[model samples]
Target: MATTFENLLYDLDAATGILTLTVNRPNKLNALNATTIAELGQAIAQARQDGAVRGILLTGSGEKAFVAGADIAELAQLSGPAAQEAAARGQAVFREFETSPKPVVAAVNGFALGGGCELAMACHIRVAAEHARFGQPEVNLGLLPGYGGTQRLVQLVGKGKALELLLTADQVKADEALRLGLANHVVP
Candidate 1:
């Protein structure tokens, strides 16, 4: 049976022992808002504690996005300290994938920008659909990636490419993402 915690849906595969986490915000392109992030963190913690969950597959609900980015509306209202706190919360939540004893894989079906890209980077592996797109367009908003994007992007792609992307805020398509080492695989 699948369980939903606010904006996240958690389903454990009986045969494969793989838990799938779906970010359930298609209307907003599964954007990472504060509530959604909190729900996602809770679901991940639950999966980690569940003995039946051997691994995790993370994705978004709609075909249009696997999390387009952070919720811009919520971000616009934040005070300086509040914004910092929000970024810290998102970073800690994304860190769960790295610290998880069970492997966490990202199924990058569509857009993965800003916090979305950082979230994918936290995973042990990433598989992208042919139409998937990745970027850290925080620069366009006068903000740098606040969710470990700089560090993880550098670790995945080389420092040169990471810096270029960070500075340009240019989106990378699936094939280029695979070639650049941002994604492990790209399927057509």
Candidate 2:
């Protein structure tokens, strides 16, 4: 069966009990735009509903990033209601992945910031490359993470660490992330 999606940047392949989902917008550093988010939500929902897919591996197209963050341009134009809707959509999509019966693994290559870090946390496991960096820098942009970051960060890394990271808005290296139990494994 062929899958339909609005964003060509995302590539989904189901095979051998694994549904491999790739964020294909390398030129944009695999940023999560609205269309990409919608497609990802649909793809993940389809995978959850499909009996053939036992596992999901989410990664980026190139070596740059798993997902840098949300599309800043799109986010830059949102008002109060529009921003709320956007956050709700992102939460719903990430929640779908989080609650899925099948396991989801994030193969984080490089920058997994803001919503990207939240996305990784929503997954069952995360495997980061040696160079991978993680953070929630939304505060720097005069905003906070709208995609379950506030809660999930606390759950994953504890209140103190979560607070520190969120307040400072600094990126953590792969080893540091692993040390804090943020990332499961670090690949060379």
Candidate 3:
């Protein structure tokens, strides 16, 4: 059976007990907005409580991106308290995947930038498609990644490389991601 939300698609593989959660916002390249973040939290909570769900496979809807980044439109409107709250909410949701007892795997099919990269890093394992690209590009906007990207990028790829990427806003391809230990596997 499949459960559909405004911005997500939750499908269960009964035989394997795997829940596939797709970020369904191809028009926005699966950007993480506040509503999407809240929905993800709700879904993760449900998966945690459901015995039928043994693991999770997270991915985006389109071939262009797993998640391109946060919703830039919404981000442009943030102010004092709202910005902090949004960052906190995003961090908390990503932390849920990080601490999940059941494995949470990211299937990175394409661009995983900024918050997208942070989300992928939070997963227990990351599987990237051959054309996948990962990076923390918030520096280009005169800002830093606000959703645990800095810390997780450092943890996955080491401080030197993480700093380089964060500083330059350069992207790494799937093979490089695997070599750097950011991705467990790369597929065709």
Candidate 4:
């Protein structure tokens, strides 16, 4: 069965007990805005509470991107304190994967930049499509990845690679990401 939320599409497989959550904003490449992030948190909470759901597979709508990044328009409107709070809220939502008893996996179909990359890092396992790209490019906007990117990236790819990627703001292709230990597997 499937249920559609404002910014998300959820489907559950009774046979496999796998719940798939799709960020449903293909027009925007499933950009992470406050509302979308909140909706994701709600979905996570719901899945955690439902015994029928054994695991979650997180992905984005469309073939072009898993999530391009945060919504620049929405992000640009935040004040200093507002920015801090927003980051906290986003981090909290992503952190659910770590605390949840059920595993959360990320299916990176395309671009996963900034908060998108951060989201992938939160997953217990990550698999990327052949054309997928990953990066933390917040530095281009004079900001840093505030949604656990620093810590998670370090943990996944090690400090040296993490620091280099952060400093360069360079995107890595699926093969490179897998080779660097950023992605567990790559798919066609």
Candidate 5:
């Protein structure tokens, strides 16, 4: 089906029964701006409702990031209420993926930090390439993950590991992430 949303960069091929949704803004490392988040939500909803699609793959457009995080430029200007609304919208979108009936896989080829990491965690399964890196560095920016990161990370790695990662605001390599059970599979 043809979609009006261009920023999301969706490619749905009927023959393969695979729907691929790519974060198109490689220049910005495919950061989750309001528009990108909206488009992503729409795309996932469409895919889930479409009967032909058996599986969905979410990925970034470039090798730099699966999604670096939220758009810091846009987020930096938000006031109290605006920030709250942004968080709410993000939560709703990510929740759609988490509860999606069809299987969703995240192909993490690079940096998946903050919201990026949360995005991957929302998927049914995650496959990270050798070059992929994951982290919850929101603390460094004087913010916490506003998009389900705290709960999901704790569920995957337990409270101790989750707290260490969140508190330190450190990046974990793919191997370490797999060892900690943060990733389902790590590939070269």
Candidate 6:
């Protein structure tokens, strides 16, 4: 059975013991708006307490992106403390995934930029599709990755590569992501 949400599809597989959480905002390239993030936190919390769920598989709804990024429209309105609070909330929710006792794996089917990339890094493992692209393009927006992207990208890909990616705001293709150790596997 699947739990209903406005922004997510939360389904638990009894046979596999894996809870699959799909971000369902393809029109926005599955962007993480505040509502979606809150729903994700709620679903993850339920999965954590559910004995039936042994692990989690996170992904997006469409072929274009696992999650494109944070909702830029929502972002455009914030400044100072408001922006800080939003980032802090996002960070806390992502932290839950990072500290989950049950394994959380990201199925990176497409673009995982900004907060999307951070979400993938929070997972215990990331499996990318052949066309998946990863980056921290926050620099272009005059913002830094606010969801542990700096630390996790460095941990996954090494300081030199991480710095280059962060500074340049360039996207890494699937094969390159695998080479950089940002992705565990790339499937065709």
Top candidate by lDDT: 6
Across 55-170, the per-residue lDDT of candidate 3 in tens digits comes to 99999999999999999999999996899999999999999999999999999999999899999999999999999999988999998999898998889889999999999999
In model 4, pairs of residues that clash are none
Q: Stretches of candidate 5 above 4 Å error? A: 1-4
Q: How many backbone clashes does candidate 4 have?
A: 0
Worst 10 residues of 6 by lDDT: 75-84
Tens digit of per-residue lDDT, candidate 6, span 1-188: 78999999998999999999999999999999999999989988998899999999999999999999999999998888988998998898999999999999999999999999999999999999999999999999888999889999999999999999999999999999999999999999
How do all models score by TM-score?
0.98, 0.94, 0.98, 0.98, 0.97, 0.98
Give lDDT for model 4: 0.94
Q: For model 2, how does the per-residue alpha-carbon lDDT over 119-153 read when each residue is reduced to its tens digit?
A: 99999999999999999999898889999999999
Residue-by-residue lDDT tens digits, candidate 5, 76-137: 99998999999999999999999999889999989999999999999989999988999999
Give per-residue lDDT, candidate 4, residue 188.
100
Model 4 lDDT per residue over 1-188, tens place = 77668999989998999999999899999999998999899999999999999999999999999999999999999999999999999999999865789999999999999999999999999999999999999999998999999999999889999999998999999999999988999999
Displacement of the residue 23 alpha carbon in candidate 2, Å: 1.3
Tell me the TM-score of model 4: 0.98
Clashes of each: 0, 0, 0, 0, 0, 0
Which pairs clash inside model 2? Answer: none
Alpha carbon lDDT of each predicted model: 0.93, 0.89, 0.94, 0.94, 0.91, 0.95
Of models 2 and 5, which has the larger lDDT?
5
Give candidate 3's error at residue 167 in angstroms.
0.7
Clashes of 6: 0
On TM-score, who's better, 1 or 5?
Answer: 1
